[model samples]
Target chain A: MSSCGVLVVAGTHGNEVNAPWLLQQWQANPDLIDAAGLAVQKVIGNPEALRRRCRYVDRDLNRCFLPEQLEQGASGLEFQRAGELLRLHGPSGEQPCAVAIDLHSTTAAMGNSLVVYGRRPADLALAALVQGALGLPIYLHEADAQQTGFLVESWPCGLVIEVGPVPQGLLNAGVVEQTRLGLESCLRALYQVRQELARLPDALVVHRHLGSRDLPKAENGEPQALVHPELQGRDWQNIASTQAMFRAADGTDRCEAWVGGEIPVFVNEAAYAEKSIAFSLTRREVWPVEPNWLLALKQLLAAA
Target chain B: MSSCGVLVVAGTHGNEVNAPWLLQQWQANPDLIDAAGLAVQKVIGNPEALRRRCRYVDRDLNRCFLPEQLEQGASGLEFQRAGELLRLHGPSGEQPCAVAIDLHSTTAAMGNSLVVYGRRPADLALAALVQGALGLPIYLHEADAQQTGFLVESWPCGLVIEVGPVPQGLLNAGVVEQTRLGLESCLRALYQVRQELARLPDALVVHRHLGSRDLPKAENGEPQALVHPELQGRDWQNIASTQAMFRAADGTDRCEAWVGGEIPVFVNEAAYAEKSIAFSLTRREVWPVEPNWLLALKQLLAAA
Candidate 1:
């Protein structure tokens, strides 16, 4: 990579419409977006899926990003698309993307969050810059290895911008605006980092991954409870052991917490229901911040 | 027909989970629901669709209630299901539903609304009772003859309890509580009607249906405009002709209203995107009401 550039991917899942729509809108009016010092390569991840107005045709494209999966030449439509994405935007590309940013929307109440796969210094630094700019939470989800096959994992420096509560295949003007603001902010941060004017506060707060809780289901697989009234729409809030989670069908049994002191993320997410996951829990972890991190990280990423 | 009975239907669309879940909860604990003076029969509309967690397997079940479709013996999955629904809860069933109330949730910011299909005396009286009890908007959508195949149309006294902005196949606890409250209020109104203690005002206001505006679309059919910033979440508000409706992708052309004095309903509705509708416009109409309308209507409905 000559100096520094970024690849922004959207609609990694076909159902997410906001990010790709934002990119399309911005591209249609390029002057409308200010990307002062960045070489931006925008790609809609799965066009076919988007056209069908469904999540995916075969397998989820986001889950097709594993290194081995790309190398082994899998036969699924998403696997083939994964190879194409790898060739076009992966690190091994002729003009590799110095940084990759995936845009996503959720049916969850996770309001404009930055997701980091790991605590890699570069990723954390970039996330810190954006977080510092937006004051949004950084969800450090590193534990679920099964979910490691994310689009951003293909690049050395990458992060995911997850915004909601927008449903799949639907566009909310507010969500579209938020996505644009986020992309603009990310581009501005990139410009600042390229100009060596970016700094990290040596310490940061992150919601570290714990695990996900599943909604109560019956033996035949129907949900047996409703999300507790108290915890509904209370995403990103800390809960105690005494907090009610779900109200049983019988109304006599209310499911309360066995474990406390954990903050719930993706609470009552609509998409996760297909996967049988209710919501993921995270515990906040504060780490000492490092200074001049973005510049250093950019230099490191460029050389990679 | 029974002297006083009510049929509450949920999951008319399989994807809408909250209402069905509410019914399930009520069924599991019948005593939890307050219907002391009423005989309530709760039914989940589309079980197969609900099991698959989809809106509909064949067609929208809610749109299969046309009298001609039922008489013609339509063959689609939803059409067959419509026949089944008619036999079970429709007006000509062995044990016909006295008052049919379909519970639905939307992907729009429609806070809580009661939808009446026509201005039949009984239907209007029932709606007026519920409107008085809950103080929610009564949307009188009678113009769209094509979209008139609603489940509520299957009975003489019927209406839809529509609540939002919740996603399909997802349950929001707050929405569930709202659904329950709406149902309870409906039930209370039924009980009052049954006891001949119901009263309706001499006048009422309704948001009369006008028409729908489609989002600007590109040649390949992607939305080319955003719901104007000014009208993003301002649902149920009257817009002047000077007000912007959609902001074009090029940002130079803002689509302003050509008509004024109309109120927009389901503004920025997520589901409408798939159907090429941006938002629906309604004009409020006030009509003269008669005294002791509920009791007279109840007697009329009972003899029907």
Candidate 2:
């Protein structure tokens, strides 16, 4: 049996304090560990500005992963710090059995979501388990070659969890809770997968859709009635066509669906404007995953 | 006549020492007097890492022009420094008559080149004059909406020059002399444009092409070749078709030409990609310009 290791990457965008706060809180709670039988390597993506409730001091740590930048030592403070963490805890040349989760949050009024990227069976299985446990929608966005440069992208299996907007009202407490729950759920899901591959499918496919939000109303009048789509669990599918099905908010009319699909599986965003949804499917076999080429190019450039 | 101002942006990427070094030297020189008939502003993009001879300390300052990131103050050190410079020297609530030239250099090889990006006719004329004076090819790359975060993009008209590769040798007197000469040449070109535009043609058309250097034979005795297409220039209204043409190194087989009018302008490697060429057409006209959308978006997000 492969020895499982979990890498919990928190604060990828320095301003999202909840992820790091949660990890720190969990570290102080020994009881939480006793309940979850999993070992985790927690990494704070950017600590410099997190102390001041700022996003970052120098650059967006998320987007500066090109190889030439690294070679020139031009990376921001946060990226350099994160690179140090990767050097210390990332997979060795021997290839450890591990999974990486990069924690983030959206500026939009999005609900809790997990963006599962990469094409590894283990990763898909883990994503499905986490979705099932958290009950939050799973958004399966294809990692564009140019956009995959985070430390998690280097791993064979990885997921990025956008925990919605950070609850500013509760400050550190909210950040801590969200982070703790997320990490715990991921570990539990990974454990379940390790113990029961026979019961689970080889992969889980997810489709995502975007919607626009209703605007605020005038002072003298009540806000216009806003009706949202009712998503019935039965409407979800494991395998389906990749076309985007556009429906009226109140289900009054059916519009054309946008083009979407992959050869062996069909996954897409199911929700409309104002909100986003993802659909998932399970498959038995897929091609062997390789390191992302765009990322490799960026790394080469930075190194050059 | 609109009062034209020149913003000399230096250190866009921290590793390119020639940019900031030249700017600093010019700043201290007595010859760079306003009496020379130009309102000049020297702005440093990333001062922190530039001092260290590294590319950047936190992030690539050039890529962090997104509105939300700027609003949240989520940026690398270089980004912050650039932002500060923008705030200090950028146009106020009212539009200003100014042009910016962000300095840069290539890492691959030594070729002095100029890059002009934007859709304005006046901008095109200015670019043409500079190219003519500098004796360099003009690469006309279309401005993508996503790339709107650059400071030059923030301005209505701007130019980026790849003077040459950063010399690996120390800051010798000869290196300084070469740097001074490059800066002076650019300044002279800009001054000439401001003084001579009325006498110049209503539209300027220049033909350009790209070439690559063939590397020496490897141990296996196979010669290395760099392949790319040649670009031809024609009047925008009179061209039969804007198509790309190519000529290989061996001078044997000529590749087919591509239709070009709708394509964006780009130079693979201005100085060092062996034999790179640039082609452009310049016409005169006026345009209404606005603040960079990314910068505006940052403000909007901050207010929200």
Candidate 3:
């Protein structure tokens, strides 16, 4: 089945400024990004939120793509925007999108990684290709009901390019350059897949999302402890029960809450405080790539 | 000379979450802050903005202390908040604050510094004493009409305790500890001043405010260039005109825009983008401390 094109969305959360700035640069100079003759459509995910330089207007736009969201009338700014975006770039919309790659930056020390929601064939193929090419880690985000409705879920094949250790609404050179490289790399892989010249790696490594943990809080929802200094920037590191994961108000270590052998991602993400998620735990896994996954990606890219 | 108690203000910009978190801990456990038996009243600068986890409600609350702001009827959330704060903690209010130490955190690479506005004798003396003890670099901000009405400027003897390189609304242990140590050091200085035993530094080192530089922009108020990779995190370092200070959209070095010998501070400060200030220039100077400054501090703290 043919599709519209590749939809490259940036600034889904307004406060993630680096990706949006790169998008603007790409818009101005089409040659800046090496799309390699593919029809790439660049878009700002949340223009209103970006204008205000905040994460969102009413609710997180990234979390607005659930099936149940569109069934109700739009009430908030993000709710309305989610509907408008679908009308313009949904699979069956005027601009009908074949695949989506959402660009995002985080306050956590998450470096550059691909966030693939669920185990979709095309998504796995694309993430594996990028990981093979760039040696970047894959975050297989699935089975967390508390974190659903990702913006990329609206497309046939989609994933998120998340880079970090940078602050919200601040442009950093390192972040911009990494984002530029990751995006161009994705486009190059897509072009190769279109011509059936793509090479799929034998094994894919991913940090499977297990659950999220909030900082210990009081009845009034104020955090009783903070992510311990030892664990603040130690994202993707394995921890043991003897390790200190949190710090009490008195500056003493709180180790009783440690999850042994559990790897943490998005450690102390600044925006996660709103969701009460100081960090989320994951389990590292290795899996063999399925042949059907590469076929799905080829089909999707041919449509693009 | 009997005066009111020392006022410690936090959350002045609301988005600066580290210092405020320290304040909450201090409030819960008064012993957390070493006030040295001197009366210290902790206050939140902007409660509404803090609740929203934003820098300000309407205008920047730090800029709401100008004389004309209070003369007019309060309109914006920050304006009303400024008035309310003064009514409760101002020099002539029921609490009658003596010295104000406004705590702030920034996105810039500035690490643990003091910001003294103008050369108020008391402010300078207090800053110099802290400098003698902590060896912190002081940024003497003055003669910049564009930047005024700081929250600490209202008190007789006050200066800003600024720590940074941390993201807004995020708490880091280094920032928290620096703020705590700086605030405690100032309190120790004041205690010495009360007993007329404070030893003001012979010569104070400061980065005098020279001017500010904004990234090249279009008429639409959008930045055309970013802070150069070589200069982004090099705050407080002297730059030569030959050095590349900004990068063009194509990643080429833009050296022609560099200002020679201009030490920049607040480089790439996230909030300053709203005011079009990418980085501010400064000139380092060493000045002998005047005896009158010590006398002024003594007179002010003798009543504390």
Candidate 4:
């Protein structure tokens, strides 16, 4: 069988410190990962930014992984880091790891979540395994493919482990512990599949990404209103189209009150303020998966 | 004697949108402050930052108001804005407003509180009045003189109205209402003082600032620890020095355990992470004040 291994990365944004802290904890105590037999390639995505305690020195490393961005030369620190990381682990790299897991924290009320780039079978099965193991709802980000430059997209079987409501540059121990638990559960699930003991549900619940909702802005693009108070901390709950999305400055009228029921994933994320995205909407779907077949089949095929 | 007008400023940090939203709401409906009969100069600090929904364009506007920094020429948008604001309502300005109230929201567990720069008599009296009237605790920030560049320091009886546990760039309605209530209470107390009807207790509780605690870092300065799980949301609560301050990544030992007690303000503050302050410690003190002397004398003197 092919060597079973996984590439685990944290601090891709530098500001999200809890994941890196958890990873460090894992390194300090190998028992934390005793159940996951896969060879782990632990990486700190942006050590420079982490040292300075900022989100990014130049551009977001999470968004600098595209082949075109890498070929265009190192325009910034993130670009350089992305190129180096790609050369070390990409499909053409000598190490050539297939399954990669990226850790992330959000400044929104999205508790613990799993984000899948698209509906690739291996990715879906892996997400299903994590979901079944941790009860974490998976967020399928498939709509905005054009804007995709996420690190997990570079690998064959890869996904992002997201946790938070914690702000950037700060670490919440609760979030840190949750992230560690999530990581452990993910690794355990992967180990189960590798040992031919995994059993994922035939139909896994997933939140399919539609589009992001931005707070209403004035002519100059300053926010004309804010997220409705009622919707502030309610992250995974479904909001009916009739429900108010934003409240105007006057607090008189509600803006962006849509007409369909959709759930918001990153509700009131502090970091997305710079990006003009209030939250992203999703529609729930039950995706079918081949469960234990993925890791075992892939391992056997690789060995052949 | 000064004219007893109040200059209320909000949105100093573009991300703290609730206070500014409340201010805008009040502006749209003036009757909300009909009782607080003071000439209100409702200024939105960092308008450019607010326009773009960010913390600041160049640097933190709140930290750019040092007298030396002001005289040293414009460093960025904040400096220019500070110069303009000073020109309009500063002590040396044409308007020369004496009582300035700066509104701020923190991404920490700091509940409703008042921040006094130093032990200024008038500032204390004002804080006492607010404490008595609104039942809000006062935070006496006397340490770290070099880092003092707050906007409220420009006026005679200036202070900051800080409220939170809320993240930046997101508005929590509960916090919004709380801020509004706090603002109204402050204004009412000021009006009472102007009318010689203000009453302050003899002993007021205050949190005396000692110093800030940063997360444990490695030789490279990246945080090697996180806030202790036990201390995550315990703001305003007394923490014994024997209690764990931070949990090392290894989860083996507590990193910064001490042997005293301190009440931590701004615990797990997301914004302060960039500044390397995990939390700020304060010693609780009961400050003595001359009961009801402030309003009686000030009003009598103004009448005379």
Docking class of 4: acceptable
Query: What TM-score, computed on C-alpha atoms, does each candidate reach?
Result: 0.90, 0.35, 0.95, 0.85
- Each candidate's interface RMSD (Å, one decimal) is 3.0, 30.6, 1.6, 2.9
Error of 3 at A63 (Å): 1.1
Q: If both were scored by lDDT, which would come out higher, candidate 1 or candidate 4?
A: 1
Q: Which candidate, 2 or 3, would have the higher DockQ against the true structure?
A: 3
Best-fitting candidate, scored by DockQ: 3
Q: What are the per-residue Cα lDDT tens digits for candidate 1 across A1-304? A: 2356688998888889888888888787887678775778889899899887678889888888888867888788889998887787777775668789899988877888888997777888888888788888888989796576888878878888989887676777777777777777787777777666777666778999888888778787778776776776667887767877887644444655557678888888777776777888888888887654555676855564
Runs off by more than 4 Å, candidate 3? A1-4, A72-75, A257-260, B1-4, B72-74, B257-260
Judge candidate 4 at residue A294 and give its lDDT: 74
lDDT of each: 0.78, 0.46, 0.85, 0.77
lDDT-best of 1 and 2: 1
What DockQ results for candidate 2? 0.01
Order of models, best TM-score first: 3, 1, 4, 2
Q: Write the per-residue lDDT of candidate 3 for residues B1-304, one digit (tens) a residue.
A: 2353898989988899988889888877887877877777888888888988899988998998886868787589888888887888788777887799999998898889999999999999999999999999999999999998888887888989889889998978778888999999999988888877789879999999988888887687666778888887888887877887678666877665555567889999999988988888898999999999999887776654
* CAPRI category for model 1: acceptable
Residue B293 in candidate 1, Cα distance off native in Å: 4.4
User: Share of real interface contacts recovered by each model?
Assistant: 0.45, 0.00, 0.52, 0.55
Better of 1 and 3 by DockQ: 3
Clashes of each: 5, 49, 0, 1
Evaluate model 4: give its TM-score. Answer: 0.85
Best by TM-score: 3
